[model samples]
Target: MTEQKRYAILPLIAIGLVGGLLSGLFGIGGGVIIVPALVLLLVMPQRLAAGTSVAAILPAAVVGAISYAVQGNVDWTAGILLAVGIVIGSQVGALLLSKLPVGFLQWLFLGFLLVVIVSLWFVVPQRDSEISITVLTGAMLAVTGFLTGILSGLIGVGGGIIVVPVLMFFFGANDLVAKGTSLVMMIPGSLSGTLANWRRKNVDLRAAAAVGLAASAASPLGTIIAGTLAPSMSNILFSIFLVLIFTQMLVRLIRAKKN
Candidate 1:
């Protein structure tokens, strides 16, 4: 491998390792971590970064969902219903993305990330066990999925931040089940959004593949590690990751304002 390719390997592995653990622990798809890392480490353009992140998320989420499923943590009925809404919402969001300026979209994504970080830090509910999903619960799930899908398409986050919180707070899902369900919902939405971006030549297939393969390979180990961590420790790590990302966004936004 050339110098650039060699340099990319470590980051790819790091992203995969960290992203998978986060996904397994938090019910997040790792897009928040992946997108910012790609931008900071690889100097990838925003559009390609988003697209590649989405692409990598597909496999990572799959691995995460499967792991959670084996632990009897998946709620297939709710997951599939939510996914239906997510697919439609993602398509609409992609259409909107095509009309927006790239800079505006970047700012929007940064703003969204800030909101998620703050919410996860300050407002997320505390609970240890899984909650049951009813018909009423399914309706709420659909709405959350719809909004998450829209954001996923716009920001390439695969909707994990939104999905996890909703499942935890509103739907009353346990952390493990919520994470698994989020991964399940993310599959179709990410795939759809990625295809939309791919049509616009925004996806870097080679880079995505490199990162995704590593992520898939490492996800089972990450999931096992996640299962070992205390919930409080997992929350702390997740909070720190969010704070770091939020700080990065703040710096970029300030720099942009100055420019």
Candidate 2:
């Protein structure tokens, strides 16, 4: 491999390992972590980072969904319906992103990341049982999916952060079920966003594939580990991860302000 390729591979593998663990534990797409890290560490351009992040998210979500499915945690109907909305919304969001300025996009993404970190830190808690999906709840789910799709298209995230909280808070889904459903919902949105980026020639397929494959291979292991943890232990670990992510974002924001 060329020096540049060799340089990229190590970071990609590191991203895959951390991303898979986060996906298994938090029901997030790992793009929130992966994209920023790529930009900072790999010197990847923003659009390329977004596209590559989406591409990598595909395998990670698939592996996570499968693991959750095995535990009988997936809600197929909800996932499919949410995915449909996500795909449509993502198309519109992608078009809008192309028109926006780079600075604007950066600030917007930072703001969104802040919101996610705050929500994860403050809102999510361990639930005792699954929530019943009522008519009102279904409508809310559709709305959340639409919003998440737009965000995903704009930022290259898989919308899992948004999906998980909504599932937990509004739908009363258990953590495992929320994680499974979020992964299932991500498939179509990620595909649509990735295709849009591909058309623009922004995707780095080699990097994406490498990271995706590694993340997929590691995800089941993370899920198995998650299953082994006690409820309190899992909660504690997840909280620590959230705190770490929040601190990273804060440092980024502070640096941006300084510069």
User: Candidate 2, after superposition: displacement of residue 142 in Å?
Assistant: 1.4
In the range 29-93, model 1's lDDT, one tens digit per residue, is 78777888888888887767877788888888898889988988788988987898888888777
Tell me the tens digit of each residue's lDDT in model 2 across 23-82.
776677888788888888888877778878888999989989999899887888778768
Itemize residue pairs with steric clashes in candidate 1.
Answer: 27-179
Q: lDDT at 187 for candidate 1?
A: 88
Each candidate's TM vs. the true structure?
A: 0.84, 0.85
| Candidate 2, poorest ten consecutive residues by summed lDDT | 1-10
Query: What is the lDDT for 117 in model 1?
Result: 58
For lDDT, the strongest prediction is 2
Query: After best superposition, candidate 1 residue 153: deviation in angstroms?
Result: 1.3
Stretches of candidate 2 exceeding 4 Å from the true structure = 1-7, 101-128
CA shift at 56, candidate 2, in angstroms? 0.6
